[model samples]
Target: MSDTRPTPIRPRPRNDARVVTEAAELGTVLGIWAHPDDEAFLSAGLMAAARDAGNRVVCVTATLGEHGTDDPRHWPPERLAAVRGHEVAASLAALGVSEHHILGITDGTCAEQPPDGVVRRLARIVSDVAPDTIVTFGPDGFTGHEDHQTVSRWATAARATAAPRARLLYATTTAEFAGWWEPTRHTFPVFLTDELPLRTPRSALAVELSLDDARLDRKMVALRAQATQITGLIAALGEERAREWWSSETFVAAEYAESRSSWATWQVAA
Candidate 1:
């Protein structure tokens, strides 16, 4: 039998915001990402929202994102892994996540085929934690990075073996509106979900969290706390200004769900 699964077709966002409300409190959620700041950039708000709604959220990062820093002053290869690991721990805490696990794969590269031992280890963790939902990079890896792709692939496989009842969600890009696309470069921004434009046949479920300016400010504060990653950008744009730029986050559900239609409770609009 083929490992690939079918994708679902979902509805476009309604002009009416009332059609969607806050998602029901999920029992437990596991977010698997390739790097330190991936959670903050892509799903911090969702994590915050979930936590506020009383869900247990945990993170599994595949790599330290050691290759991502531009400042050679702080990130020599020898110390990058350790530094980024600490940063991941700190960042997840800021997001209200109490539990975190790092697979400790190589910073720039991951195993072409993750070892059966690695899979078993991840499976054991998942079985113990037993999250109701698993979120990770889509098949395109958001920008088709090999490491991100590898983690997503492994997360999917791990979901099957570890917790078959868990809902698996591959985080994907949504239609670009606002200044989301790289206007100057005429491409997707590097190292973020803002760049991918391809559409998959997968059923997509949308989740939107509405926040007031005060809450948004708090979110941005948490974002800026990860100094190793976005410090320069935060300095240039100022904290609140940068938050305004990417305040509203969007994600699409791909594979792992029986029907996209059932995800409507997770959707909320402005």
Candidate 2:
């Protein structure tokens, strides 16, 4: 479903204080994702925005994306983990995110067993950081990946026990409508706003960040720093096309519990 019609663009509001205050400025933000580049896609803008506001941002990726890609001649599983790990570190550095950790979970194997230990590991991180906010995939795991769902489960359980006061949010996607970039059919409306019904929790608060080409380029550069996967494709696409692919970061706050009396960025239950 594409909108072929042209529409006028309205300017975004310019209340600096309002914008600053409205953006959730949590004391610490812990982003738990299923794979290496998952956080780079969904949370980079928010993380950059958070860091700009002086908040600590930590990322705990569940796996190294060792199962990514099909180039047998290029990347075997044994090499993929270390290569992607370095790429993750580089990407994090580019995005100004300092705290990065990986859980060493086997990629594509999250569904084969119970996740008690995963839950414990997540809880331990929660206990240590005690983040004011915890961000991860929604129950549908964004793309319904078992690893993502398992990670979400473990994150929520950890939030419940170790950091009851921490607000929980989910990173989501525009996947269903992410198909409008067909170069031959690149109508602006259809290409940009043919959004899908975001499949995260219905009550999740939607957050959108609009960026200029420069900011988008910065983000793409951060993403491109992950040479293990995106490098070849991004180089093929060129910067403008790459920017189209990387612009307008979106998210949803799936489980933020407002604390009773605090004016915190994310209100966590006591």
Local distance difference test values of all predictions, in order: 0.63, 0.66
lDDT top scorer: 2
lDDT of 1 by residue, 1-270 (tens): 433332444553454123222534446888888888877776777777778778889888877776775655677755776777777667677768888888777665664544676678778888988998787876656665667766766787888898988866666544443334455334324543332443432224445555557556656756766677777777765665567656655555444222211111111010
Error of 2 at 59 (Å): 0.5
lDDT of 2 by residue, 34-55 (tens): 8888887777777776776788
Q: Which candidate tops TM-score?
A: 1
Q: On a 0 to 1 TM-score scale, where does candidate 2 land against the true structure?
A: 0.73
Estimated TM-score for each candidate: 0.76, 0.73
Residue pairs in steric clash, candidate 2?
Answer: none
Clashes of each: 2, 0
Question: How far is each candidate from the true structure, as Cα RMSD in Å?
Answer: 7.9, 10.2
Query: Candidate 2: where is the Cα deviation over 4 Å?
Result: 1-24, 174-204, 212-214, 235-238, 255-270
